[model samples]
Target: MLTMAIVILLLLMCATIPVAVTLIILAFVLGYFYSDFPFYLAAGEVLWTNSENYTLIAIPLFVLIGEILVRCGSARKAYSIMDAWLSWLPGGLIHANIGASVLFSATSGSSVATAATISTIALPEGRRLGYSEGIFSGAVAAGGTLGILIPPSISLIIYGIFTETSIPKLFAAGVIPGLLLAALFCFVTIVCSVIKPSISGQRAKYNWKTRIVGLFSLMPLFLLFFVVVGSIYAGLATPTEAAAIGVLAAVGIAAAGRSFSIAMFTDAVLGSLRTTAMIMLIVLASYFLNFVLSTLGINEQIEALFSGMNLSALETLLLVFCIYIVLGMFIETLSLMVITLPVLAPIVFAQGFDKVWFGVVVIILIEMALITPPVGLNLYVVQGVRKRGSIMDIVVGALPYVLAMFVLLYILVIYPQVALYLPNKV
Candidate 1:
C-alpha cells in the first residue's frame, strides 16, 4: 500500500500536477484501499484538525510580515545596510547577499519568503553592478535557507510542536549553527571569488559615516527580531503570539516608511493568504496520509526494519540523515518535515541523541531541500526573479552551498555542542 501511494504520487508529480492536489489524491486512495474508515470522513477530520491548529497560525503571520517588509522597502533598506558593511569583501555584493539574508532570516520565518524578499532587492543590484547570475542568485537562494535555521523560525516551531520539545530552546539552539552556516557561506563566496575572479564584481568601499548612517534603516528588522524572539525566550509570548507581534511590527514599519498604501497592504495580505492556504492544504493532506499510513502499520514496519539493522546510534543517525537528503530532493520542506518527524524523531531519541541537536540538524537538511532540484522552491524563486537566467544557473550556483551544508552537518554530528551550546548557556 505504501509503495502504491508513493508510486502514484511520484507519477502525479512527474505529470506536473500541483503538489497539494497530488497529496490529496494520494490520501484519498490510501483511505479507500488501506483503511476501514470512509474516505470523506477521514479527509474531513484531517482537514479540520490541520486548519484548527493554533500554532499553525504562525505560518501566515510570519509570511505576511515578510511580504510587508518587501513591499514597504524595508527589505531593501536592510540589504543596503548589510551591503554598506560587507560590500568590500572579495565577492562584493555576494557577501552582502549572504549577510542580508542572515539578517532577514533573524526576522522572517519562511525560506521562500526570505528568498523572494532578498532576490527582489539584491538581484537588481547584482545585475546593476555586473555580478554573475550564478553566484548572485545562488547566494540568495542558499543564504535565504537561513530563514528556518535562525530564531523566530516557523519550521523549528512546527518541529517542536510535533516532537513535544521546548520551542524556545529549539529557537535558541538554532542561533549558533545558523550564524556558523552564514559565516561558512560568506567564506565559500570569498573563496569562489578568489579562485574565479570573473564571477566577482568590483568591491565597493564605504566611509564609516555612511555605514553608520545606513545602520539607522535596519532598526525595523532588529526591532521585529527582538519582539518575536525576545518574547519567546522571555516567556512572554508563545511562538504564535510572537508571530502576531511580528506582523503588527511589520505593518507599523511600513506605515512609518510611508510605503503602506491600501494596494500594497492588500497585496501583502493576499500573498500571505495564498501561500498560507497552499501550505495548509499540503500539510493537512500529509497528516491524513500519515494517519492512514500509521494505522496500516507502516510506522511499525519502518521501526522493525531499523531495529533489525542493529546499528550503533551514530550509524543510525547517519542513515537517517542520508534518507532526509534523498527525500528532500522531491518533497516540499514543510510537508517533508510533517511526514517524517513522527516516524524518525523517536528513533533518534531512542538512540540517545539530543532532540534539540537533532532539530538543528533536521533544519539544515530542510534548508538543503529549499535549493535542491525537481522541487527546490528557492531555485524557482530566484529563477522567477530573473528574466534571463536558466534554472540550471541557480542550481549550479547553489552547489557550493550544498557542499557547505554537508560540512556543517558533519561538524554538527561530531560536535553537537555547536547547536546545544547557546541554548544551554542561555
Candidate 2:
C-alpha cells in the first residue's frame, strides 16, 4: 500500500493538478481501493480540526512580518548594513549575503522570502563588484534555507502540529543547530575563498565609525528577533502570541524605516492572506490524507515492516536519511513533509527517536530540498534575481553548501545532544 501510494502520488504530481488537489485525490483513491471503512466521512472533521489548530495562527503572522519587511525596504537596508560589517571577511561581500539572510530568517519564517529578499539586494552588488556568479549566487540560496531551520519557523510549526509535539520545544531545539548551520555556511565560503582566492571579489575596507553607524541600522532587527524568540523562550508567550507581537514589531520597523503607509500595510495583508491560504490548503489536504492512511493502517504496516527487518536504530536512521535525500530531489518541501509524516512518523518513533529531534532532523532535510536542483526553490529564486546568467552557475555554486548540510547532518547524527541541548536545558 505504501509503495502504491508513492506511485500514485508521483503519477498525480506529474499532472497539471495543484499539489493540494493531488493530495486530496490520492486520499480518495487510496481509500476506495484499500480501506474497509468509509474514510471520506471522517476527513471533514479531521481536516477541520487540523485547520483550526491555534498553532497555525503563527504561520501567517510570521509571513506578514516577512512581507512588511520586504515592502518597507528593510531587507535592502539590512543587506547594505551587513555588507558594511562583513565586507572585510575572507569571502568579502558574499559573507553579507549569509549574514543578512540569517537576520531575516530569524524573523521571516519563510525560506523563499529570505532568499528573494537577499537576492534582490545582493545580486546587483555582486555584479558590480565582480564576484564569482556561482559562489555568490550559491551563498544567497544556501543561506536563505536557514529561514526554515531558525526560530519562528513556519515549517517547524507545521511539524509540531502534525506530530502533536510541543511547538515551543521544537522552536528551542532548532536554535542551536540553526545558528551553527549558519556558521557552517560561512565557514564553507571562507574555506572556498581561501582555497581558490578567485571565488570572491576584492575586499572593501570600512572605517570603524562607519561600521559602528551601520550597526545601529541593524539594531531594530536584532531587538525584534530578541523580543519574539526571547518571549517564547522565557515562557512569557506561546508561539502564536509571540508571532502576534512580531507582527506589531515588524510594522514598527517598517514605520521607522519610513516605508510604512496605509497602502503598504494593505499590500502586506493581501500578500500574507494569499500565502496563508495556500499553506492552509496544503496543510488540510495532507491531514485528510493522513487520516486515510491511518484508517487503512498503512502506517502500522510500515512500522511492522521496519520492525521485521531487524535493523538497528542507526541503520534505520541512515535509511530514512537516504529516503529524504531522494524525495527532496523531486517533491516540494511542504508537500513532502505533510505527505510523508503520516507514514514515517510512526516508524521513526517506534525506532525510539524523539519526535522533537526528528522534527529538527526533518527540517534540516527540508532545508536541503530548498537548495537542491530540479525543484530547489531557493536555487530558482536566486537565479531569477540574477536574470542574466545560466541557472547552472548558481547550481554549481550551491554544491559546496550542500556538502556543508551533509556535514551538519553527520554531526547531529553522531551527537544528538547538539540539537537536543537547548530544548532539554530550557
Candidate 3:
C-alpha cells in the first residue's frame, strides 16, 4: 500500500500536478482506501486550525519584507554594496553575488525570494562584466539557499510548527552553520576562479574612499537584519512579531529609497499574498496528510522497516540522508520538506538525535535540493531572470556547491556542537 502511494505521488508530481492538489488528493485517497472511519472529514478542521496558528502568521510578513525589498530597489542597492566590497576577489563579482545573497538572506528568510531578488539585480551586471553566465547564475541560486539556512528562516519556522520544536532555538542554532556554509561557498568560488581565471568576470578594484562610503549603504540592511533577527534573538519579540517589525522596516527602507507609494505597497502586498497563499495551501495539505498517515500507523510501519534493517543510529541517519538527496532531485524543496518531515522527524527523535540539530541538517539538505537539477527551484529562478541561457548552465555551476553542503553535513554529524552551541547558549 505504501509503495503504491509513493508511486502515485511520484507520478502525479512528475506529471506537473500542483503540489497542494497532489497532497490533498493523496491524503484523501489514502484515507478513503485504508481507514475504516471516514478520515477525510477531519481535513477541513485540520487545515483551519493549522491556518489559524499564530506562529504561521510570520510567513506572510517575512514574504512581504522580501517583496518590498525586491520592488523598492533596496535589493539592488544591497547587491551594489556587496560588489564594491567583494568584486576584487579572485572570482570578482561572483563573490558579490554570494555576499549579497548572504546579506539578503538575513532579511528575506526565504530561498525563492532571495534567488528572485538577487538574480534580478545581479544577472545583468554579471553578464555585462563578462563573467561566465552559468557560474554567475549558479552562484546566485546556491547563495539564495542561504535564505532558509540563516536565522529568521521561513523553512525553520515551518519545521518548528510541524515538529513542535522551539522556533527560537532553531533560529539560534542555524546562525553559525549558515554563516559557515556561506563562507565555504566563497572558498569554492575562489578556488574555481583561481583554477580557471577565464571563468571569472572582469575584476574591478574600488578605491578605499569609495569602498568606505559604500560601507554606510550597508548600514540600512544591517539595521534591518538586526531589527528582524535581533529582536528574536534578544527575546524581545516572537518570530511573528519580528517579522511584522521587519515588514515595517522594509517599508521604511523603501520610502527612504524614494520607491514607496500606494501602488508599490499594493504590489508588494499582492506578491506576498500570492507566495503566502501557495505556501499556506501546501502546508495545510501536508498537515492533513500527516494526520492521515498518523491515523494509519505509518510511524509504526516506518519503525518496523528501520528495525528490520538492524542498522545502528548512524547507519539510519545515513539512509535518511540518501532518502533526502534522492527525493530532493524530484520534488520541490519546500514541498518535499513539508511532506517528508512527518515521517522523518519521528525517525530522528527515535534515534535520540536532538531536534534542533536535525533541523539544521535538514536545512542543509534543503539547500542542496535548491541547486540540484530538474526541480531545483533556485535554478529555475536564476535562469528565469537570466532569460537567455539553458538552465543546465545553472545546474553545472551549482554542482560545486553541493560538495560544500556535503562537507557542512559531515561536520555537523561528526560535531553536533556546531549546530548546538548557539542554541544551548540561547
Question: What is the lDDT of every predicted structure here?
Answer: 0.86, 0.89, 0.90
Per-residue lDDT value at 131 in model 2: 94
Model 3, which residues run further than 4 Å from truth? Answer: none
| Model 2 TM-score, all chains together | 0.97
Model 1 stretches astray by more than 4 angstroms: none
Sliding window of 10 residues with minimal summed lDDT for model 3: 35-44
Rank all candidate structures by their TM-score, best first, as comma-separated numbers. 3, 2, 1
Q: Supply candidate 2's per-residue lDDT for 205.
A: 79
Please state the error at residue 252 of candidate 1 in Å. 1.8
List the lowest-lDDT window of 10 residues for candidate 2. Answer: 35-44
Order of the predicted models by lDDT, top scorer first:
3, 2, 1
**Model 3 lDDT tens row, 1-426:** 678689889999988999999998888888788888887678778888888899999999999998898898878888888888888778999998888888888888899999988898888888888989888888999999999999889999999998999999999999999999989999999999989888887877788888889889778888998998789889899999999999999999989989899999999999999999999999998888888878888767877888899888999999999999999989998899998898988887898999999999999998888999778999998888888868888899999889999999999999999999999998
Q: What is candidate 1's lDDT per residue for 54-90, written digit by digit as tens? A: 8888888888888788888877887888888998888
Q: How good is model 1 by TM-score?
A: 0.95
Question: RMSD, model 1, all Cα superposed?
Answer: 1.7
TM-score of each: 0.95, 0.97, 0.98
